[model samples]
Target chain A: MEKQVILDPQQFDLTVTRLCHELLEQHADFSNSVLIGLQPRGIHLVSRMLDKLQEILPTPPICGNLDITFHRDDFRRREIPLIPSVTNIDFSIENKKVILVDDVLYTGRTIRSGLDALLTFGRPIQVQLLVLIDRRFKRDLPIQADYIGKSVDTLNHERVKVSWKNIDGEDRVELYIKQTHE
Target chain B: MSSLSVDHLLGIRNLSVDDIERIFQTAQSFKEVINRPIKKVPSLRDITLANVFFENSTRTRLSFELAAKRLSADVINFTASNSSVKKGETLIDTVNNIIAMKVDMVVLRHASPGAASFLSKHTKAKIINAGDGTHEHPTQALLDAFSLREKLGELNGKRIAIIGDILHSRVALSNIYCLQKLGAEVLVCGPSSLIPKGIDSLGVKVSHDLTETLLWCDAANFLRIQLERQDSPFFPSLRDYALQFGLTSEIMESLNKSIIVMHPGPINRGVEISSSVADSSDSIILDQVENGVAIRMAVIYLLAAQIER
Candidate 1:
């Protein structure tokens, strides 16, 4: 198996800071803007973005982590799913703009489930999707990312894995393609 | 395996030491949350939890329901008498219907011992065994353990005696497993018939005399008589059982001064334990009830996390 690096550690940080600034500029008032990070990698990304937002603006956005395992579409097909991390959103999302953050956008099923889970809290005025890497694959739903770091063209069987030094002890993006046995 | 997940909490017998400790630590976190002014957490927000009670239970059912709600999870209450189960539907069918509604967890209390385990195996939703027959009440045991840990600082080397109808009380069975796992010497005291044979295999001592058992323990857990057990040949009469095994004020005073009294209650005032002892300073019955919610919160939270992975 061969692994290819797309983004280095420093490059990833700059892209995230740029995304944070762009998001801050869009929600200029910052009164009803909140960031909800999807669990695992997105949580760390949200934390980093939150830190950058605090330095740029007088007040930072309210942030939370969400685990959408229970709301997955293929729950019956799996043997028992492992418990995910806690979803901590203290403020109500009613009439507020929620920016859902994730590390990678693959099939978009996770974001769909995240939307389903978020609806149970309250009705949001709008929800915008954000992803570090937007691999151009056929999405099962009509959903598309509002803010994308980079668009990468890839085959259907290939996988892109993002590792952060703060989380996975390294900062790199690796792409792995499925191998066919002869 | 790097991680383990329980589909349901049927009993403590099958639980590993690490699993029990994880629940305790999670409950400890909720205990801190309980002391806060808000008294709620967003850990389980947007999740839906269903409480399915086949038998009537005010204390156990309410505690679990409140625990779920306090976690910001939406709760749906289902009673056997009001549901299709009363219309001759089987327990499995009823549970399956709830699962179809996409509930995240099910807190069940059935009159059968392995009911929770059965439901857990059948459903995708997580199960918390509230009380099932005389089999086991894992949450009650967790609460009992929590209360003991609060008072004694640790469960190691504590001599605890569970007194009264062991054969018909799920609390006794659960406490036995939990206490033994936590490094406590457990003693069972009651009429010979109510004490199951071969209970010593569980590393617990059996004593027929209450006075002797009281003298040898630091805590006494009294179990209530199941009115349904009265017809069985287990005992001659309720009066006789009371006179022989009951904890009167005088009987309590005769024991070691530091001994704590406990009962998984809705107490039969003067039947198994005296009213004086129940309300005394040495009694932790209320503490057990209060800890029930926190422990259950921990169980749901940990189990939910595992299922998410």
Candidate 2:
């Protein structure tokens, strides 16, 4: 099985830096903005982006980690699922602009559920979606990322894995395509 | 359209007053079931309930496990130390694996708020949150409410003081919701730091003085201080905490004669509450523990019956 490398560690960092600058330029007032990272890989990416954003912006946005594992749409069928990280939003999101961060965007089911879970905490002024990699697939919901790092066209059988130095000991994106048996 | 299936018993905050009252009424039926000679029922026959405990919780976990078994359900015990959860399996993945075995329910306990709520969304099996961090213990609240109902016959206009580590105690939060919904005047008394901010917004009064709260309430629900607090900055010193907020025998004597004492044990004998008060005639601590089984049985039975019907 041949593994294709998409984004190297340095390349991923540059893309995140560019995204942070773009976010600051558009928003103008970054004080009220908050970055919410989806559990597992998204959380690591968000932390890295937050570090970059802190250096660029006047007042760094409030960043929190969220785990939507329990909020998934297809819960009944799956075996014992891994308990995701804690959902820690100390400050209220009532009127603040929230940018949800995720590692890879696949079916967009996670993002949909992430939005649903966000609503339970409080109503936000606006919610912008950000993904490290956007593998354009048939999305069941009308949801799109506000900022996307890399767009890769792939078959339904392909799987993308995002590994970070902070979490997975290595930083790279790998694509695993299912093989056909003759 | 029917309501969203309450797949998990997270807390009373989301539940309407009617829904809470209905659960209490159902619990009353199970209370009768508990009084029987067999003290067991076949309501949950052949059902499997997994007790996934990620934290050290003995009473709540045991009561829940017993409740499920009393209903004739098979109980599987999994602790954080022994389970594959220690080997990097995510909480959801572990739960998903268990659910694949066709388990009917998951009674979870984690040392983080909203843990059970998070689990409920990931699994199709009904979730009974045994205790989730300092957020809520719905069944404990249900049983506390049931015990109160059994004692007073009515909760409306009754004054109840919840003393001790309110910030870290999910029991206090659940009791506040249950007591307030049942028309009881809830007062939370503890150290300034241990008292969570905005708790007054829950329609309960907050006080730092324990004696004042004791005099004003008909019942005092004392919460146990987690041993882990010894290292935390929540309190200045254990001796100071005991002097300021602890429920001593002398303090219990000063309270109104009709006032009852309640504690969600395992009691810290000399701390938070003294031995005399814990063993006092007015103390309902044992009753709370016993009622825990019946109340949990009621919750499982009610939730399961809802699915069947």
Indicate which candidate wins on lDDT: 1
TM-score of each: 0.65, 0.61
On residues B1-309, what C-alpha lDDT tens digit does candidate 2 reach at each position?
A: 122246567787777776676566556555554554445544466578899899887888889888888777899998998878878999899999999998888888988889889988878888888888878888888788778877888999999899888888888988988898889999999988888889888888989998889889888888888767445678887788889988888877666466788888888888878888788888898888888887787677656654432
lDDT of 1 by residue, B1-309 (tens): 123245578889888877787777667657655544456666577578999998889999889988887777899999988778767999889988998998888989999879999888888888888889889999999899888888888889999999988988899989999998999999999999888989998889999999999999988889998877456567888788889998999987666476888998888988889898899998999988888888888788666655563
- i-RMS values of the candidates, in order? 7.8, 16.7
TM-score of 1: 0.65
User: Top model by DockQ, which number?
Assistant: 1
Chain A: TM-score in each candidate? Answer: 0.93, 0.93
lDDT of 1 by residue, A134-170 (tens): 9876577778999988778888878899988877897
Off by over 4 Å in 2: A1-182, B1-5, B229-231
